[model samples]
Target: MNIIEVEDLTTTYNGHTAIKNISFKIEKGEYVCLIGENGSGKSTLIKTIVGINKKDSGKIIKNIPPEKISYLAQNNMIDLNFPATGKEIIMTGVQKHKCLPFYKKEDYKKFADVCKLLNIEDIINKQISDLSGGQRQRIMLARALIRKPDLLILDEPCSGLDVNITKELYNILNKLNKEDGLTIIMATHDLEEIKTIGVRVICLATTVKFDGDIKDWKGEM
Candidate 1:
């Protein structure tokens, strides 16, 4: 099944074209890596797919509803000084579907399951500011997963992390995609980092430069 289909998509920011005439289709349960140089429209394309930015032209057909898709943007935008606990942050994912401010027993249980899967159960009570970069990323991922989304979109998820930590994060995402059957589309410039988990590669340079299996992507890096 095609989870997302973008046909000749174009997007602009303040009248400046970001991505132009890009087209692609994301299949169900596929792990796709969006790669390109800086300001090459990788972020712009995914943002358009996720509906974060409006497309200036073309059509986007999403098999899943907007609410069923979970997104993790480029950077952690939450205030580090915020006193919210890990659990509190994760529970916020359920707020969109809730009529009350408080979580029910099942909501708490789902949060616990997601925490255990992410291996952050020990820090559930800890403040977000107290965790390491990796731990904090995991918390954010857990929060994204609390929605049980069919499609997971992440933008430059490993922007400022060491190689080892970045690989660990990919392993977690691999498990989620391979084991749990979640379709994932992540944008990153580091091709080496995705060598282990990348099933498909979509290289964009303000357009569709290449779109094929990872092994067939022959562009010079």
Candidate 2:
């Protein structure tokens, strides 16, 4: 099943074309990576996909509900002093309109499961500002997964993590994808990490430069 379809998509900023006439389709349960050099419109394309920016032309067809599409931004924008605990931050993934005096039992169970899976249960009560960069990223990921999103859109998920921590995070993501069949769409510059995940490759150089099996992508680094 095609979860997302983009045809003839175009976006421009200040009279400068960011992405020109790009097109692609993402199938259900498929892990795909978007790769390109700096200024290649990768971020612009992601913003357009998630409706943060309006497309200049063409259409996008998303089979999943808009709320089911969870985007884990590269850098979280929440204020460190917001006074929300790690668990509280994760609970926000539940629908905002749903009125509830407290998180339901099921919600707590899911949150616990995610924290365990991410190996962050020990820090559930800690403040977000007190955690390391890697821990913060993992918490954000747990928050993303708490919603049980069908499609996970991440931008530079391992951007600043150390080598071992990066490997650990991807290991968790790999387990999630394999065990739950989650569909993942990530924009990353980590070519080595991409090879480790072994997913389909989508290269964007101001447009759709390549899209096919990962084994077929022989572009130079």
Cα deviation in Å at residue 60, candidate 1? 1.2
Estimate TM-scores for all models. 0.94, 0.93
Model 1, range 95-132, lDDT digits (tens) per residue? 77677778789888889889888889899899989998
Could you say which candidate leads in lDDT? 1
Instruction: Evaluate residue 97 in candidate 2 and report its C-alpha lDDT on the 0 to 100 scale.
Output: 57
Cα displacement (angstroms), candidate 1, residue 138, comes to 0.7
lDDT digits (tens) for residues 30-120 of candidate 2? 9988899987888888888988888899898999997788888774555766677898888888755567658788888888888888889
lDDT (CA) for every model shown?
0.86, 0.85
Clashing residue pairs for model 1: none
Stretches > 4 Å off in candidate 1: none
